[model samples]
Target: MTSPTISQIGEISLIDDIRKQFSQKLRDVTVGIGDDAAVIKPREKYLLLTTDMMVEGVHFDLRFITAYQLGFKLISVNVSDIYAMGGIPRHVLLTIALHKNTPAEFVHMLMNGVKDAMTLYHAVLVGGDLSSTQDGISLSATLIGYAGKYILRSGAHVGDRIYVTGSLGDSACGLHVLKKMKRTVSLNKKNARGSMHSFCKKLGAMHGGPARSGLSWKIVEPLVRRHLMPEARNPQKFIRDATAMIDISDGLLIDLTRLCNEGSTGAKIYEEKIPVSIEMKKAAECLGIDPLTLALTGGEDYELLFTARQGKRVSATCIGEITESQRVIVNASGKERPLSVGGYRHFQ
Candidate 1:
């Protein structure tokens, strides 16, 4: 039996199904899907708006990732921007363009991912536009959030300390491993635990297997999962004392450079202080890649990197301090080099 495609299902029916899937009643939402536009109630706090796009070839590859993961990541990446400003995500709008021949099952899985992410973030899906594309998929999301007080990248002072909420480089390393495997691994809760043995067997068969180098499923699972479904870090705990903030979406050096540029200041971070997970280290070694390079220059970690004034207690890892004029990275042996930006850029 041939499975139904979007072309066979028709746009009207698909949209109606989508509306039913996301139907929700929220206090702030006056009008949701099935309306011309969404109406949102005004809030007393400051409003934070952000939008992000994920194009098929440019942002992701379907071969290495599932539609479910893609949908979840689309919401996560946008929410990270709001969290970077110390805000609580409230509402969401999505726009998706897909090839008419795309499978209905794929669309359903994608929506399930999106719905799960919306629930995880306590956000409501209000309204969005859907369209047919000639070729690849394009997804965009707009997130609305509220904050009593927001942090900005331009607020750092020369004496502030720089911090990161969690470990880095795992996503980049995971991506590398996935590219080598040339396959997808489902990290969904229901199926992952029972399928580890088969997944490891598949991993072992790839190019003599990095598993031969002691990269077990335990080591590879987290790395790939990080790439597939990264949760945005909420800055509520550190927002009070944060002098400056940005999410590590495009690598530490590039994002830190952005923060420094916004503040018209400089920074000095110690190489030894940058956090790298044990899994990432082992995986990188098996792949013959430098863990520090991935940590410093890789993209899409979504960890919050912020600065705070000295003498205040912060729950994040303090890797550096703000400087008066020069941006540099201090090595373990006291060697200093200019901090150069490196990460994903659309155009060369």
Candidate 2:
């Protein structure tokens, strides 16, 4: 029998089909997949669960990525969600659906990546499922975390200062490299190993470090390898003092807009104060792309965009201030202009 088309089944039906495969366990399960992850009540803490899925073609390309990098990235993305809510990740469960021809060695390498990440983040792999598929590889991880008091997107006050972590746009640089690799594959196929090594060298030179810094080998390699990995800013402690918080999954402008929209306020972001990485700037120049736009609209950085009081006791830098109006503004060249939320829209 032919498989049902994604359009015919729709997202909800597809979710239902997948949900039916799991046998319900555990009592006091207040919520499940519909919201984010499954929420189970503990004796003292509230568990926030979230899961993310990555597919080979749609989410990442294997030609430029190693199995280990893929494994590490899978956990990082899910961990970012927990951090966004000021939660500490406690455990994770990973499910892999691999093509029948996929080598067991490759799978082991991927698991090694997962193991490395768990050790780095101090999270445990409680349990998971494995299966074979006819199509491509798919990895899904369910992350369980604990929060004393959740910092949500809906808690921004009117006078909070917007802050973000780390420099932005490196992931976009990685994506550019992947696109170049795909186009040059035919000519460079014979020298694939050499070419990829050179590409990684260039990427490292741009970033000023080898992709992996020992413990972060899995996490950083994918960012340098395929640009498919998301960052986990791990802002649990930072968000504890924040008035509002959000993950930069949809780019700075878009995710900040979500925070502002939630609080019914506006902002004045200083273009000069925005953090853009050196590697990102070089990559943008090489690709003829605007660095600012990449910082503004490039998605999947996975950094935290949070808000706090202007003089709050936190180690956050204020890139912008909250305003009474409900529109975002960019201050550049001593002139202010309205900023648009033209960020990555998955459906679009």
Candidate 3:
């Protein structure tokens, strides 16, 4: 006999079943899973908490990733959220749903990844839950951090310089590569040289691999790894002077629109000023997609999009200045036009 599947019960029904398993009252819990994270009030400091879930098909593919990489990516993504809020991460709770036959060694590797990330960020892994799943692995992590002052999306002022940490569109490029590898493997299943296993090993060693003749490894691998294990740029020290801030999980255009809408303001962004990586350009050329659109609409960059006062103590470059028009404008060459607000919407 076959077991019942989650799809058979539906998304809402699965959520209801999970909700029923948890206790009604959780100690020291001011907030819980329904929101970003469970907020617990501390006597001496203000607590900021958030959680992120990584689903196998949606967020990752198990065939191309090692357990160690999966573990690190999971923690890094959540830590990025904490950094976005201008907070110092202190602790994390992990909940993992795994298939029954998964190896214990894989679990150990995942734990090692979590442990390494926690040490790097000064975050402690306090506790969590583990359960069996029928389909694929699911990992969720809740991070608790503290902040003297919280920087929110609704705090922009006119004339503030908009700045972003790091270049964009690397993750989208990486996804393209991974998808291409998968397709190639599917078409040539019997060939050992061009197999998915070979691709996975190549991806794993990409950082240390020999540079291709006439191509720079320095330029290529960083972009691929940027998608795999992006370093969270913690700007808690800089937030004291920030007028408004947001994480660039989505593309710049979309995330900027979010900031504008939240702050009830408008902005002007220069097309030439937006940073574009060389690898992004290469990938765009190969895919026949516009690099600007990728930089504008590609999601999961995890860089911070922030507005700060000119000549502020914190160093930042001005991409554009905020405008009073209540619209997002993009200036390219001598041409100036309004940029459409486009981003990843779950239902749409």
Candidate 4:
């Protein structure tokens, strides 16, 4: 007889069955699995902890990504949370559920990716648990860091200006390029037979066809890498002056809306003031999507968004200002329009 699948056992039962697998405890981790919550030893300095989840199909596509890249991204994303709060990450706890048939080499590569990212940020993987699942792979990362001072979104004042580090919309544009290129390739494969092959090839060329132009891959790979491996901006000189700060996990509009709501203020962002990279602009042009719109709605740039006074000399763009009113507004050309929060939402 075969063992029952995790779905058949239900979540609670599954947890109970797998909980024993991670029975070992660290000295600092006074309490481990099978408790209301894990407890750790008290520390004198300020502690920072943040968690991030990535579902296989929803958040990433394994078709074009390596296990290592995926692993790197998982750790990097969690670290971004720590940095967003003006903290430095020190440790990570990774949990993953995957099909039983996943190769051990794959797991090794994934962990190697995690190691690669941890090395970059100077963090460590202290502990975590693994479980089997019938569904696709799912990963969650809990990161711990510390900071001398905590920067909260509620710290923003009405007179503060809005700033963002690096260019926006590149991640979203990269996603489009990857997905469209895959579809174009798949469609061509399905239709590339006999007389219709030439016709399909032309259509594919028009729609993100890389086979016809070697330059296509050269151009798009960097952008796709941006999506796969987003960097967490460092909190350097700007942290001292920033009243409030956040990482752009969701689109700019939604994340900024969160900052404004927390601060009990409105915001006025200038459209032209939003930064766009030349590569991102090129991707948008090929896809016929407006780069500015992507900047507004695209999520997961992993750059810093903060509120500061006008005189600071940090390497960030002043995209907008905090308003005393009760609504978020965007100024473009000569017209100003009320902006609504748009970007990645968990559920529709």
Each model's TM-score, in the order given? 0.94, 0.74, 0.76, 0.79
The global C-alpha lDDT for each of the candidates, from Candidate 1 onward, is: 0.88, 0.68, 0.70, 0.74
Model 1 lDDT, residue 181, Cα? 70
Candidate 3 lDDT over residue span 1-348, tens digit each = 544543454445544444443324444555644455556555325678899999998888876566776787788889888888778787678898977666655666677777777778877655576777988899999988888777888888888888887787777776666555553122112553334445544643453432231223334455556666667778754445788888888778888989998998888888888888887786555555577777777777888899987767664446887776556555565477776754333211
Better of 1 and 2 by lDDT: 1
Model with the higher TM-score, candidate 2 or 3: 3
Q: For each candidate in turn, give its C-alpha RMSD to the true structure in angstroms.
A: 2.5, 9.1, 8.6, 7.2
User: Which stretches in model 4 have alpha-carbon errors above 4 Å?
Assistant: 1-44, 183-204, 207-215, 237-239, 326-328, 342-348
Candidate 2 runs further than 4 Å off: 1-44, 182-231, 236-240, 343-348
Lowest summed lDDT across 10 adjacent residues in model 3 is found at 184-193
lDDT for each residue of candidate 1 in 275-339, tens digit (9 for 90 to 100): 99999998887777788999988889999999999988899999999999899999999999889
Query: Residue 110 CA error for candidate 4 (Å)?
Result: 0.8
316: Cα error in model 2, Å:
3.5
The stretch of ten residues in a row with the least summed lDDT in candidate 2 is 212-221
Model 1 vs. true fold: TM: 0.94
Residue 217, model 1: lDDT of: 75
lDDT-better candidate, 2 vs 4? 4
Q: What are the runs in model 1 whose C-alpha is more than 4 Å off?
A: 193-212, 342-348
List of clashing residue pairs for candidate 1: none
